[model samples]
Target: MNTQDRLIESTRELLWERGYIGTSPTAIQRRAKAGQGSMYHHFTGKPDLALAAIRRTAEEMRAKAEAQFSVPGTAVERVTAYLRRERDVLKGCPIGRLTQDPDVMADPVLRAPVDETLAWVRERLTSILAEGRERGELDVAMDPRATAATIFAVLQGGYVLARAADSVEPFDQAITGVLGLLTASTPATRE
Candidate 1:
């Protein structure tokens, strides 16, 4: 890749591996195999480069979710697909992990993409659930907004649970539990 691209990719990796406070410009330059001049020439400083990296990560997350959301399936099916999508579960979420970083959370610029991306996911899920309810696929009493929030919570929480236990089983079990709850709420079809 080009120098700028290398720098951004390196920053993303470093940010994922180390929080903002832990990722230094020197480390990023070292990882990118680019000198200080190359980095400064392409960007103002560490924050600028980090912002670019974070935004890229957030965009990728959205695109991946959109892949599942746009697929041909019922709301629950699409959601299940998203939940079951391949992921580096042990590595945790790139964006979600940032929320735990004090430096990232303290800075509005760095936090914006993380906040917006998560909100978008929840909103998209809510719309899907609402559509399903309108189609009578989901129960009439189901609250799309609430259910969406629950799904979001379980997905993120699963990542934490799995990481804490150093196993993916907790994450898988959490997903299965949530999926079961969703299935149980599906309206029964007439024979």
Candidate 2:
């Protein structure tokens, strides 16, 4: 890859492996194999490069989640597909993990991508639930926005629980529990 691309990519990986405070410009340069001058030439400094990397990660996360939503299925089925999608469970969420970083949370610029990504996921899920209700696939009484938020919370919380326990069991259990709740509430199953 080109110098700028290499630098951006290296920063992305480093940020995922190490939060903003832990990732240093020197480490980025070392990983990218680019000189300091090259890095400065492409960007102002570490924050600028980190912003680029975080934005890229956020975009990728959105695109990946959107793919699951786009598949042909009822809302519950599509949501189930998304929740059950393969992930590096122990690695935690690339974007959600940043929410815990003091530096990332302190800077609005750094936090924008993370916030936007999560909001996007919740909104997308809400849309799906709303559509399902309209189509009678889900119970009419179900609150789309609330259900969406719950589902989003379960996934992020699952990651935290899993990482804290150093096992994927918590994450799997959370998913299973949420899936059960959702599936049981579907109109078809309810009737």
Candidate 3:
């Protein structure tokens, strides 16, 4: 890849592996195999490069979700597909992990992408749930906004729990628990 591309990609990897505080400009240069001069030439500094990387990561996450949501299925089925999508469970979420970093959370510029990505996920989930209720797949009384937020929170919490335990079992259980609750709320379950 070109120098600019290499720098952004390296930043993305470093940010995923190490938060903003952990990823130094020197480390990015070394990882990208580009000289300091080259990095500075293409980008103003670390923040600029990091923003680019974060934006890319956010877009990728959205695209991945969209792929599952766009598929032909009932709301619950499509959401189940999203929840069951293959992921590097042990590695944790690339974007969600950033929220734990003090530096990332402290800087509005650095945190915007993380915040926006999560909001997008919650909003998408809410819309899906609303559709489910409209179609009578879900109970009409179910609150889409509340349910979506819960789903998002549970997923993120699952990552933290799994990472803490050093096993994917907790994460899988969390998913199963949420899915079970969602299914139980569906009309099919009542019928």
Task: Report per-prediction Cα RMSD to one decimal.
Answer: 1.3, 0.8, 0.8
Candidate 1 residue-wise lDDT, 1-191, digit = tens: 99999999999999999999899999999999999999999999999999999999999999999999999989889999899999999999999999999999999999999999999999999999999999988998999999999999999999999999999999999999999999888977422
TM-score of each model, in listed order: 0.98, 0.98, 0.98
Question: For candidate 2, which ten residues in a row score worst on lDDT?
Answer: 182-191
Clashing pairs in 1: none
What is the alpha-carbon lDDT for the whole of candidate 1? Answer: 0.95
- Order of candidates by lDDT, top first? 1, 2, 3
lDDT of 1 at 182: 92
RMSD of 3: 0.8
Candidate 3: C-alpha lDDT: 0.93
In the predicted model 2, the residue pairs found to clash are none
Q: Which stretches in model 2 have alpha-carbon errors above 4 Å?
A: none
Per-residue lDDT of model 3, residues 24-138, tens digit only: 9999999999999999999899989999999999999999999998889899998899999999888899999999889889989989999999999999999999999999999
Candidate lDDT values, in order = 0.95, 0.95, 0.93
